[model samples]
Target: MQAWRVHRNGEPGEVMRFEETGRPVPGEGQVLLRVRAANVNFPDALLCRGQYQVRPPLPFTPGVEICGETPDGRRVLATAALPDGGFAEYAVADASALLPAPASLDDAEAAALHIGYQTGWFGLHRRARLQEGETLLVHAAAGGVGSAAVQLGKAAGATVIGVVSGPGKARTAAALGCDLVVDRRTEDIVTAVKDLTGGRGADVVYDPVGGDAYAKSVKCVAFEGRIVIVGFASGVVPAPALNHALVKNYSVLGLHWGLYAAKDPAAVLACHDELSRLVAKGVVEPLVSERVALSGAADAVQRVADGATTGRIAVLPAGAGAAR
Candidate 1:
């Protein structure tokens, strides 16, 4: 078996080494999966740099989510258990946590659906309770996490405002069903949202890119609105302004989607069901921009970490069903 391993903490392209290795053995309550497609996530790079919240032991694989087939021939999506992640031809995951892959989506799309879409669903519907006809602002709206929120916001009937860095991303956001697209490089996000909402400001702000995006969201968020903090992708976690939040009467909600798997597993399953229905209806789809071969896993992770790509990148193992 061939897998990419991280021996030391550093940039993903520099630290990740592709090598021939023995297939991982599943532990008790775990199952070995033949990897079909592994989704590249920002956390993969954080894992390489030893900066993620959960640090696995040294010399670990970095992929977190995968579309794979079990020994019983069941196709499912699983959160790859650490140390032996989904970057190889085969990976292991807890049997209880595997989700049946949506029949409407291919392996790459199914792999891309788990984390990002679940986070977006929980952030918008559960935490913020975003309503129909409300103005929703999404930061980094062309990137993987933000793009999911954009599509979900539209499906929820919110007027979506997508804030992206460049023209290319702005166009992508527009195509993702955003009602309005703001390029942060050349436009003022606050003014754009305020203008689009007739000066009422955005009712909900989905922020995956913190730092500056967080700062600007506060300035334009509607009174008594909700701001969901999804992640700090900007590399700088911003200090919250409690006084401003109080004055504006808006709520600041922090979402960690992974916690639901333990605290409220049923909710996670229900969300997956809804996401699958949306996929079946073509109301939402994972924007898989690149399908890279197993050998390009390191570069894919680095590109995601650098914020140089739009939507999701799926790594297909050699001779796997989704590999082209």
Candidate 2:
């Protein structure tokens, strides 16, 4: 099988190489999948840099989520068991982790749905308890995970304020159902959000970018508001001032969606059901901005790592042309 592998810890473009490799054999409790489309996630770049939580031994494949086909011709979404990841033509996934691909989405879109959307669903509904008619603020609102939050927040009837880095992403966020879009590069996030919300501030803050973004959220968060920390996409992990949170009477919640898949699989399934319904209704659509062939997987991952992509990018590995 043809696959891309990282032989050393480095930037994805610097270390990832394509080569013919032996097909990965699945062991007990696992299923083998013929990769159809694999989404290039930021973690792929972190894995390449040896910066992610779980680093595979040297010479590993990095794709985490994929839409795959079984030998029986069933289409499913699966998490690539590291080392034998979805970057290849074939990969192994735990049978328990496989989900039926939503009929409404294409392979690339299905591949994008699992991680980003799941994170947003869990962060907004399960953690922050975002309420209908309330204002929700999303950071990095044009990126993969942030865009998912925008869609879900709107679907739940919340007025979403999306904070993006540029005009292009602000347009994308508006198209994704954000009631208001704030360009962070030129406008002040806290001020814009406050002005949009009539000075009450956001009732719920969905922060995927930590550094300055998190700090700014603190300034504009409403009283008794809940701030859900999804990730540190800004590459700086900021320590929250717990005293300020206490004095302000707001809550800060940390969300790691993967833990639900292990600790409470039922909750994960429930979230999937809701996401699937939204997909079927066309209420939530994964924004796949670019689709690259397997040959360009490494570069796409690098683009995501460099924060240069506004939406999802999927690698088509089955000889199908990548869609725009």
Among all candidates shown, the one with the greatest TM-score:
1
Per-model TM-score, in order, reads 0.99, 0.97
lDDT of 1 at 195: 86
Estimate, for each residue in 1-324, the C-alpha lDDT of model 1 and write its tens digit: 999999999999999999999999999999999999999999999899999999999899989999999999988999999899999999999888899999878999999889999999999999999999899999999999999999999999999999999989989999999989999999999899888888999999999989999999999999999999998999989999799999999999999999999899899999999999999899999999999999999999999999999999999998875531
The local distance difference test score of each candidate is 0.94, 0.90
Residue pairs of candidate 1 with colliding backbone atoms: none
Residue pairs of candidate 2 with colliding backbone atoms: none
Which portions of model 1 show Cα errors greater than 4 Å? none
Give the Cα RMSD of candidate 1: 1.1
Candidate 2 residue-wise lDDT, 18-132, digit = tens: 9999998999988889999999888888899998888899788889999998989888888899888999899889899888888878899988889999999999998999889
